[model samples]
Target: MTAAKLPAIGCEHPMAGIARRTHARVPPYAFYEGRKQDWRFSMADEVTLVGQEAEGLAARACRGAGATEPTTRSLVAATMSAALFGPPTLGFPHLVDYLDSFRDGRISTNPQPKLNRPFAAFFVSDADRGIAQLGFDQAFDQFVETVRHFGVAIFTQTNSYTAGELGYFVRRLAAEGIVGLAATNANAMVVAKPGGPAVYSTNPLAFGFPMGDGSPPMIIDQASSATAFVNIVAAASEGRSIPAGWAVDADGNDTEDPNLALKGALLAFGGRKGANVALMVEMMSAGLSGGPWSLDTPDFRSGDVSPGVGMTVIAMMPGVDQAARIARARTQADRLAGLGVFIPGVTGTSKKEQLTIPAGVHRRIAEFAANAPAAGNMSLA
Candidate 1:
């Protein structure tokens, strides 16, 4: 189908508006700043692209893969944020999943997300089987305003694809000087007990607090599972065995085989403790948002149907003594660092403007863009 003939998605001109609305609130990209070193690819197998070039290529690729204009913009922004600041696996690698979903009818190419404010400080959105980022993007302005006015606000979304990186939601709030916590769930792949059936997704959670000293926010983002599902997939692809605690075989016995793990369930990090955390995240995300439970959600990898997961983000405004409190926190953080405590989100400022992506991933994305129908007047901003 021609780009012009595609059904209306959300906003037709989302890039210009998103760029303006988010320019001051989103943290600057720093080329994988604070990202874990283990996720990096070998330099020999990587290709470098300027930030703008990466954005342009990703946007075109999304459109070429049958995503609508608004969906393309939202996907591009979130994917870029992940690629530049969050984990490498959730960055360009994850976008490939969405592109395939769009082509396979697992993600609606022209979703029209709908928003509702059921209460003064409670907002909900239905993503209409589209990417999760579009729903959050649509409600961001109002959500921030609500948080500022009420001191706290809760934003929940349902009927969207699985969230890419939970930290991306809270990080935006931290940039605005607000403390934030976010949680999201996906299809069932994690077992609460070592020998039990899968009862939760990875069920990740993130928290962010602005440092108030012009540095990055103190952010903590992690999955409740021992390892992310992607790691298992990667191991299986490389013909490697996984760690014993990572997952269990189909018979519910712990195993070190990645191939067997794929047929079984992932284990929680700290046994029952991690399972409890996963339960809390499940309630906060899927239960509160009225989305399907992990047990009921479809698998994201092999589905022709949408997983339709949910996300919950809570934004809290600092009190009237916000400046003093923030300063004190920064001072305490400095003292802790001096005492040899490793801070998760503290990193030196990086002036790098280019990203090193896996060459194979880059070529695949470029191929999508090259094969796509012409997108007339689509803004790369």
Candidate 2:
């Protein structure tokens, strides 16, 4: 699970009840990892670079205040995701908000919603979060419980959206029993096995599933890289080697040394198999979406300039046949496993279905989610 503190995430204030249609490009800076020395003072400088309004910053500070006892160290890493992934995603689920809740889920968008032209009327869904993928019975309960906890209900879907379009979907997708999952693809963040610098980050993916029993699987997220790059960078910052297989060094050689690994490229999952998957992710993320992708380009933070990395997401519906497919797959697969073979994606579903969020993350969820606004309103200031 992402163990970092969420960043103080805020957006350009929406003018009127609606915003002037502005198709924005990716921001050119990495996420703001709040600094150690005079951080707010430092941010005053970066905010100018970001060009977000003072009102927005005020909003963020207000949102950050609720943590009865908020900590800078805790919030720094968490907030970093917000700064990095926010713009390209059009503020779907703020990275800080999602990371604050999920260690595994992701963010994504539908290109059709982003198109712009002269004298054209565009309609963003009245709903923003795509939690619709979780269906009604489940999403409603989650919303009720979450609002009871966080004071706000961030939307979800099998697709991407903004705050403006989040609510309607919550009601609509719930009626049909469709599971909603709202997630985003942040900067191409990949952690390879300390050596080979082949492609982009393993990237992060988030999902939400609804169930009649308990909360069901409302959220599932993962990094597409070898290991989460945060861990890799953390190891590097500590001058430690990443657990072998998570990174590599210059010249494509596997090295456990985190510093070298940080300097090198991370390997894709499943070796060639994982590379194929990462490639597909890259295509969907950068290729199909027209967002920045990890090309032969270098990390912009460094002089090494290659293509920047990004993400792409596709949402699917289990529909009325979801159960049938699961049952049939399970029966058929059981028969096969009895004979020595097994299923591929089924394992993923099994783990996803597990109740308690799998790691130390649940406590964090209970803590933050509990105090979040009933509408999930921002509270810090």
Candidate 3:
């Protein structure tokens, strides 16, 4: 039960050294009576500050690419500030390449194998445009199809692009009667607190479940940060200020100034617990998937290199009485609704329409749209 008795493995990251020998803390005696139980013990705090990469910037990479598309006018408006100011020079080429990947589902790694195992690994190399565009969706659909044949599938993807809207993938799968859960790590942009070093990305996580109705599935997606970095950038672009505790200044002091916060770091949603979740995500996305740790990935804002990140997707098949299970879940949801407990994402899923953007943000987006090169034809130089 001590650290010295645990197994250890040599790794490039400092935390990995600690991780190798830490699994023995939960002694073998912890198993249940007459049966062996599964247990996963992780080192969640060691590497938190080592090189937490910029997940906010990674989110911006997808937001920027989506904004450039003709079909994403509203998205463009919402993210105009980031496109115009955040990494206008270095982030553009990466965005363009990600968009190009959408035209063809050709990624470095393909998921064409059997889904019989409970876990599978999928790697989308930086080559062939990575996980941008609809490539991930295409790959995920294939995963769902294969998993449905089996009972459950847990797939991890490394070396992928910045995955935007992690819930979108799960929602569609839920509609197909497959429950889906997903999480992706980003570059470092958040801290444990104002005085603490920024050690983790506001890693986004999502889950979707089928309701057995023709309506949209029940989906919930959220970032671990106090607020998504994109919103702060948008607010800064409009010369607005953020609320206290959302971000810190360069000296690690609390600040409402968006610009100052950008120079500093974002605050985790709930102190150590949020940081713990971020680390959990980092392990699943990068640690387990053979992807670059957040600290090792290139900075998405000014670095010309691709954001080498990872995503984890899990698909679960229901039992033979699937309809009955779904009906029971709906009944619970109905009871909660009757008690005035609102379900997240229920209303937004049923409605699809454009959201209004600030005049300044909209104007900036218009200018960028008019002057930008074709997504596939962009150049880093």
Candidate 4:
């Protein structure tokens, strides 16, 4: 595939005294043609393509990496995780470069700069993509263990794709009675406001605080932007318009057009307040973690590019009287429930909620897995 040139950068100046400045830049037009524009296909047909094309290439890379077993497992695990948390189209292909980087020794498994506090830092420098959660899960488990021993812990991961929902990583800590906050930075996709140059990456933030009872943890997850980039791509692939205020055109004008949004930038959700939070996330994920700033990150929507993103996980133990604290929180939740305010992630959801993959998608995944071994992939016991 030929590389698309970056559009020349220029911004339309706002009328005098308007206070809002827009970035004048055009998005790379052909960047998404392969996936978003030419996406019309039967589910089965798409699945076949994923199996025959995507998986076939992935299998070859795994063998070349010489870590076939772990790489194959990571690919399957990422695929399963994506299926569980939707936008399934977004996660798996990213693994191609990640596995290759691992084989090439571009990614380091060692933690950097030993810390006095319970902290660990990992840098996957080579635009590594998939298996963020693999590292995240291990880091979270270690963080939880460390927090249990030291009262708090922090885990920083830099240079990976978006890594799905931040809440998914911390909720595991909450299950063990630990409070957790997770954040990540992405490629520049969200602007501080309409008519503003894109400056942030939606910069998701999530918190999981245990409520003590057997009920689910109190989980809060959201992108600071009005919408996530993946969701924009999903809408574009489906030929659906996005909601107004979710994104802006190249001129920084608000637009509901998904195609324009893909080319433009997303708006912060709550205006300045959301942008402030996004800034905080950027600091924690990229600034402190030694990852590239969102503007420097490569676009993941286009084929196997490292997102150059970063993630931070903070885990802490509740106070000494954790039970009492939880009871107090439960009282507040009960009061809110009396007022018809459901405490999401706790009172309103079932832990047993089933994840159902469409037949075609599932079949395609199965076919890919089956073909992988014969195509140079390895199996785990």
Q: Which candidate wins on TM-score?
A: 1
Off by over 4 Å in 3: 1-128, 132-135, 230-244, 256-259, 301-303, 353-381
Ten-residue stretch with the least lDDT total in model 2: 16-25
TM-score of each: 0.85, 0.40, 0.60, 0.67
Model 4 — TM-score against the truth?
Answer: 0.67
lDDT (10s digit) by residue, model 1, range 1-381: 122322333322222232233222111111122232212332235667788878878888898888878988888988887777776657886677778788888899999999999999999999999988899999999999999888999999999988887788887888888899999888777888877898887788899888885677777888888875545555665688988788887888889988787678778888889999999999999989999898888867554899898999999986777777677778887898899886656654343478877655566577677756665667755
Q: What CA RMSD would you report for each candidate?
A: 9.4, 15.2, 17.9, 10.5
lDDT of each: 0.76, 0.34, 0.50, 0.56
Per-residue lDDT of 91 in model 1: 80
Instruction: Rank candidates, lDDT, best first.
Output: 1, 4, 3, 2
On the 0 to 100 scale, the lDDT of residue 59 in model 1 is 88
**Cα displacement (Å) at residue 144, model 3:** 1.8
Candidate 1 Cα outliers beyond 4 Å, as residue runs? 1-44, 230-243, 257-259, 347-351, 373-376
Cα deviation at 239, candidate 2, in Å, is 5.7
Pairs of colliding residues, candidate 3: 52-188, 53-187, 53-188, 54-187, 54-188, 55-186, 55-187
What is the per-residue lDDT of model 3 for residues 262-325, given as tens digits with 9 covering 90 to 100?
A: 6777777676688787788778777766667766665443334556576777778756677887
Q: Which digits, one per residue and each the tens of the lDDT, describe model 2 over residues 27-78?
A: 1211111112111122221212132221233233323333221222223222
lDDT value for model 2? 0.34
